[model samples]
Target: MGSVQRAMRLLETVAAHERGAPAKQLARQAGLALPTTYHLLRTLVHEGYLRRDSGLFHLGDAAERLSRRVARQRRRSAVTETLAHWHDVIGAPLYCARYRDGEIEVVGVADSQENPAVGEWADFRATGHAHAIGQCLLSQLDEEARRDHLARHPVQSLTPYTVEDEGAFLRRLAAARHGEPVLERQEYALGTVCAAIPIRIGTIVATVAVSLPVHQADQLLPTAHRLQAEIGRAPGVLALSFSI
Candidate 1:
């Protein structure tokens, strides 16, 4: 076998043992000569792909990082597919966002040619006060954190409908009852209306939102309700919220 194949065999053998495997045991399990196993093990250790402890070998930091990356990609794919499925079902653009590290992040969006998403003419991060995602995320934070975020990103009127008064905005946020989606009309964009509902998965706090052009403004809340129901049923796709 090639050196790479031999090395992979050794790695697979090492991974099969939870408590780690001695070089001789690894050689036997991998069907490699003892000297070849030692050489590959030394190289793997030097490259941070394997850890050696008292003559036993185990997967190392690099392997863990690779596994995490793979898991994150899988979750991202699942989220994208789920969004696309609902975009087709609801016939509107779908958006996913998260409140992480005190910032609003739009992680995924699904749209089609017939039902395109609203153009992001302005930076979403800087204009969280104006968008459904940002408003919904802000609503989930405690009063102190919410005030701190507003201090940093101060709410400003993006359009005529945008909430300009900080006190009024805070009151509006407080008024949104639990299990209700936050809705906004032509506030962030001149021609689009959106709605978002908070999603909590373990320690993760995120939002699933939908947007439609002004002509279809009446459908925003209904679309959001459908999205909330779909999300409630398919919680597994959101397990990677932190990864994105």
Candidate 2:
């Protein structure tokens, strides 16, 4: 890979580890030789991309600033505009979320109609198995990562419809990975049903969902499918995309 790509990769590696990984560990994880890793770390430390403390390297303040800048830019991205259009077309709450460092964060949301749960948008974090967006992103992870994530955060019963068992959760995730949207009825909330589809740049990278009252979800499926197709056609709607 080129120098810029390598540097970005190293930055991401540090961000992922968070606790300042050692040079040997960083080198092994990043597929670089010891000498190269040391040089890269030194350069990055000097350039304010990383910081060295007690022989371990952590992301510096500059890296955090860059991350916030990227998050702000993504909030204003074209994909978010398209998401708003989808929300308008469907008449339900639509959200765009991405998986970052083992958590799914809602980056964009649109709600034109008033709903009891619409305001919950700002509070939604994809860290729990009760969320459709979280499950969809988890479905994209490899087996080991998926298992580890589940172990770290076991399923909690949120409502009568919540999947409280590990086996069922895995089954639902498998179905979601096969392009089937997982629908939860009152699982996330008493009256809510959420249907989510994985969004990809090339494969699975994020998730977009339409959430509404359980009674309304059936009626909204057609509109949701139409919106989904439009999203699939929109340029750069996903973090990954297949070029035709």
Candidate 3:
């Protein structure tokens, strides 16, 4: 395979293995000969894409920095526009989120309507389990990737309404995979209801949703439909651009 392809494969291998794979194991998984794998890994390490700890390899600070940059870049003017559109149409707080590593991070938010309950800025490392954004993004992953992600970071209950059991969470994910939007009610915060639709690109990347208070959400079905329709029409524009 070409160097670029090999590098991508190596990254995937590293991502798939949670504990940081040994050099020999990474080489075997990447299908590269031992010597070539070692050389490629060394080069990657030098370039700040991979880090070596003791004898195992993991993503380096450079890789994390790049990921954050990409994620920030994904929050384009279009995303801001989308958030604004949702805010105006729904008349409630609207936010855009994307999944990174095993967590969901909020990259953009619009607050045309005031809600004392929801904060302007979301916690950076907050779990995705209690929101539609996270569920929709998780739905986009394949079975193996989904399993790997859940294995790395098991679902946590953030509220009384949150899915606290594995089977129920899997069922919800299955529904999301079938193109159903997940409605989370006071799962992340009391008195908040979130409706999320999978913003899909071709078949992989997902990024779209509008969260509002339950009363506000009740008035937002039409607006939400419009948002979902708009997102469906321009899935690639957001997914390809945002990637942290």
- Span of 10 residues, lowest total lDDT, candidate 2: 235-244
Give the alpha carbon lDDT tens digit for every residue of 1-244 in model 2.
6877778877878888867899899888888778988888899999898999999899998888888777667646666677778776777788777676666677777776364234453335533578777777788777787777778777777778879687888877766646666566667777777877766565436778888877776765565576568777764645421111
Model 2, 206: alpha-carbon shift in Å?
Answer: 0.6
Best-matching candidate per TM-score: 1
List residue ranges in candidate 2 displaced over 4 A.
1-77, 113-127, 240-244
**Global lDDT of model 1:** 0.87
In candidate 1, the residue pairs with backbone N, CA or C atoms under 3 Å apart (3 or more residues apart, or in different chains) clash, namely none
Q: Taking the tens digit of each residue's C-alpha lDDT, what string does model 1 give over 1-244? A: 5999999888888889999989998999899999998899999999999999988899999988987888888888889999999888888898998988888888899999998998898889878889998888888888898899889888888899999789999998888777689998999999899999888776677898999899988888888898888888888778765555
Ranking by TM-score: 1, 2, 3
Instruction: Tell me the tens digit of each residue's lDDT in model 3 across 1-244.
Output: 5988988899889878777999899888788899978888999999999989989999988887887776766556667776677566656666676666666666677775364326534343445666667677777777776777677667777778878876677777776636656667777777677767765555445556666666665755565676777666666557755642
What is the Å distance of residue 88 in model 1 from its true position?
1.6
* TM-score to true structure, per model: 0.94, 0.63, 0.59
lDDT of each: 0.87, 0.72, 0.70
Q: How many steric overlaps does candidate 3 have? A: 3
Model 3 / residue 244 / CA error / Å: 7.4
